[model samples]
Target: MKSLVLCTFLLISLAGCAQNNKKEMNQNYSTEEQEVINVTDHLTELMIAKDLKGLNNLLDKDFTLTHITGYLQPKAEWLKEIETESMKYYSFKPVNRKIEINENKAEVIQQNILDARIWGTRNHWHLQQIFQLEKRNDDWVILSSVASIF
Candidate 1:
């Protein structure tokens, strides 16, 4: 009977320790996710503000942007389009967003409803955008953006 009691106590103690450890690990993971989200927010803000310099700084040189219309844009082309006002977005509101982190890489999925005027044509575009970010030297930068039209 004593041995059984001791075994039960030990099991209960170990279970409590495991639960505490899991909670701590979850908190740490949440913090890491927040960091990735912060970088993603900055990228979105820069895009909405049309901050060319900020976008340039946050986007990798070899970054690629793929549109829902089956068009692919390289870094230079996207930058030029933004700089020359060829692609203009009056407002971009994300309806839903999710972030996933794996080691040094993060994936951001954003569902946005944008009121944009592209080449003098007013349009409401609902887009599901996936952005990949790579942490380079502790700084997260956008590596790719792929979108789907809905």
Candidate 2:
């Protein structure tokens, strides 16, 4: 009678709410993935521009950087190396860049070639770099990276 009708109505309302919540959850995940990819791409652009300040802002304090030459350096050490050498002497050009985002994590793969003029001598090297990024506090930051000589 009246009780049965009320119970049915309540069940239908609850079911609709659950469906809406599930849709919202999916949208949130998609948005997070897009954010991670966009941030990583921005990082590469910063690198090409040699924007140290931008780089600092995007990188986490505990960031780990690994080179194609098997050298692993902490954040401070990496910044110091660039500072001592002068970033003007070299340029990093990344080509064939690709990004993949999943959940709160992202991976950026790119082929890079360095053009350096030091002591009036030119040095060049090809590189394949993979950047692993994580989302923290709604911002994407690089967690770790590894590169290989190409």
Candidate 3:
């Protein structure tokens, strides 16, 4: 009984420590960096929700998506694929983020566990997406995203 009680206490303490560490890591970023991260997180939400209009508004006119296979998909075509459910995103969870800002431009490397169906194959993919963004008229616009397996 004592061993079980001790183990339970240790588990609870470790969980609390993890929560504190996550909060501390988030606090390390500046307000501007958080804004950029928000845009990227919003993109994941939009993707999973299949919000084509929202995605379109958040992205640049000349945006592109580079797949892990080295295929560069143009914005219109990619949106069309999503609209047609060819490239369907079911859910996503962001696990890590890194953002760098220079003037009005930023680069965000976000790691996610993404549940998606692409070209008829469904899998939970560990994805690392590098997104290029630019601030325009007080709003951030995603310029492009290149995806790779992490």
> Considering every candidate listed, which one attains the maximal lDDT?
3
lDDT of 2 by residue, 8-93 (tens): 99999999987776456335445566566557657657765667788788888888788765789787777665555543335665
Angstrom error at residue 100, model 2: 2.4
- Sort the candidates on lDDT, descending order: 3, 1, 2
Ranking by TM-score: 3, 1, 2
Per-candidate TM equals 0.74, 0.62, 0.86
Error of 3 at 88 (Å): 1.3
Index of the highest-TM-score prediction? 3
Q: Candidate 3: deviation at residue 59, Å?
A: 0.2
Q: List candidate 3 segments past 4 Å from native.
A: 1-22
List of clashing residue pairs for candidate 3: none
Provide the lDDT at 33 for model 1. Answer: 76
Which residues of candidate 1, in runs, are more than 4 Å off?
1-29
lDDT of 3: 0.93
Question: How many Å off is the CA of 148 in candidate 3?
Answer: 0.5
> Over the stretch 45-147, how does candidate 1's per-residue lDDT look in tens digits?
7766889899999999999999877689998888787777777767765566778888999998877787766556668888888999999898888899998
